[model samples]
Target: MSDNWVVQNLQDILNRWNSTLSDIWTLITMSPENFQGGAIWRIVLNIHGALQAIGYSLLVLFFLVGVVKTCGTFVEMKRPEQVFRIFIRFAIAKGVITYGMELMLALLSIVQGVISTIMNSAGFGTPQDTVLPQEIIDAVEDCGFVESIPLWAITMIGGLLVTVLCFIMIFSVYGRFFRLYMYTAIAPIPLSSFAGSPTQSVGISFLKSYAAVCLEGAIIVLACVIFSVFASSPPTVNPDAAAATMVWNYIAELAFNMLILVGTVKMADRVVKEMMGL
Candidate 1:
């Protein structure tokens, strides 16, 4: 044959994997748009606005509750430190109310900057391509029709596995996007608790959890980069083995590496939580 059929099959698998990985990268680094024409983002923005409207009312209630909890007598409210602390709390809470969207966006920006820095430092402008070895090509081309039958079966199965892993990896990144939208939409309610000294802990925890979610992107990107390095150095294939055995070995190792990447991407949230002690 003019072209090794195994090599041609591997190329198609490589293309699909590359396309999915590119989508993952795009999801990680690009800034999300809230005001864009897309209905999903706009709906998220509208929900955020609605929650913020409700947040103002909740802020007043939280502040009053804080006053009651902190002050046994009106005299305590008159003390310089107590009065100043309450004032500071209200001011911070008000700031959050007015700037919640900007604050959420800022957190996303910082995490994305970290992702960009990591990718740049690694000298990876794009996800690394996992190519089949030249020896595999040579070996497969030497196989007779009967031997190539099993080789073709192995290749087909490997291609399916790779395609599935690629989609799994991409979908994991999409889940992150959904979380981002969720956080933005509901930020005001948790943030409003800052108006009350007693309830400030709720706001603090919310911010920490949100920040942790944002940082998951960074962790996920790092995982992909590490996996790319592993992909670049695939397990050595023994050319002396029967063609089908050699193909199966290569496919098995490739799938294993892709599985590792997919697993890491799925665990991105847990990894971030452990790193941040959240």
Candidate 2:
């Protein structure tokens, strides 16, 4: 709201940058079950419920296949010890199918705990706001008509880039939530693979991948915490420089920092997978 349009333009872009960071912070802490006031989660739960039958049917097939492959002869399978072992495997598989979603949620909750711990240890309640330096603003205010032209162009370009980066960052965070929902909705089909000894690797890999997905929140939170520390110290403005140079330096550096944070968040899944050896 500055009388100086250049100042106003810069302020608007900075505001958007701060708002997007705040939104990303909020999302990393929220659970899938609580997302969108639970509307999306309701649909996900219904789909998961419908898939339970399919998962249960697949579970029996895997268990029988496992028994056939693991036993060399029909007589070997008839032994009391073999029957008990097979019965145990079937019970475990059924239990896994029955509670697979809950298991995934529990894993997610653990990751949430990790995210909370990282934020607490880092002493950041939220990402710090990156603001336009006052020196730049005062300098911009002092620019005469001729000088203000370039200042206007600089602000316009910087503002557009900032605005674009803000949306890109927030959209990346939203995409993380969508991925979580997709993994949850189709969890049972992969989870049923646990019924077979030979095929259990499929279930193990599925669970590990889900854990990695949940761990993405932790990695993203850490990235935000690191960025918050960086934002606490804004880009230094040279008071002696031209108003345009100062603004350009500030905007370029500020935009670069924002890009760093956004890039880390966008690559959070890959980072977690690498760390977890997924």
Candidate 3:
């Protein structure tokens, strides 16, 4: 089922790309007089903007996965050695997933940008423009190119799935290690008596810190996705207008991600200190 969904999604993306390319070709061929004006520059600018969007999307994904792994390590410290091994394995798996997702997101962003640019160049109103047929506008909005409820929902679901998968994989790997930790002399102390042993306290603190970091990271990613969706909306334009709007939108997204990273780190530090009774 999952494989089928993946295949279907890929097909949908390809179809959208083909449709977009066709529109661009039609526009250029229909009126060669307009092709050399702002239309050409708009196309170029939109493509560049789309690439930038993809770049930032991947960066966000990479940071998110890192945050997840760091938190997993801290959280599993109750069975230190066992958890450590699990963390290592999970990290490897996560790296692969993150890289692939990043690549796909980038490609999708570029396709979206190209399609949107073609539409605008052909005198289509911005996706949100009330002048456009409501149904057509809505369709474009829901297509994951613009920030619509469906797109946001998909992103939320995807994040949750990834987080749940990570949790499961980590637990599975640590299950065996946990048995060994239990047999060893330095098993993690119970949470009830966590304050008595410095080592145990350190573990507890680390776990708390990790949880806080994960929470912050999750929030940041959510915010970025939301902001990106809104930012990616096509601006109302005639062929003569500059295409720099897309570039600005990309810059705004990068700024948002950076803010999230800084905030997550700060929150983690505070949570760790509090957990350790410091």
TM-score of every model?
0.93, 0.96, 0.22
Error of 2 at 109 (Å): 0.8
Off by over 4 Å in 2: none
Clashing pairs in 3: none
* Alpha-carbon lDDT, every model: 0.85, 0.87, 0.36
Ranking by lDDT: 2, 1, 3
Question: Against the correct fold, how does model 2 do in TM-score?
Answer: 0.96
Per-residue accuracy of model 3 over 1-278 as CA lDDT, tens digit each: 12223223323432432343233233322221243464643554444444444444443444445445445565555767755654564454334333433433343344345444544554533221112222322333334433333433443444344344334323422332232222121211122122222223443553344333223322323322343344345433333322233223322343343345334433533543565455
Error of 3 at 212 (Å): 2.1
Ranking by TM-score: 2, 1, 3
Q: Give the TM-score of candidate 3.
A: 0.22
Angstrom error at residue 220, model 2: 1.2
Candidate 1 per-residue lDDT over residues 62-85, each given as its tens digit: 999999998899999889999998
Whose lDDT is higher: candidate 1's or candidate 3's? 1
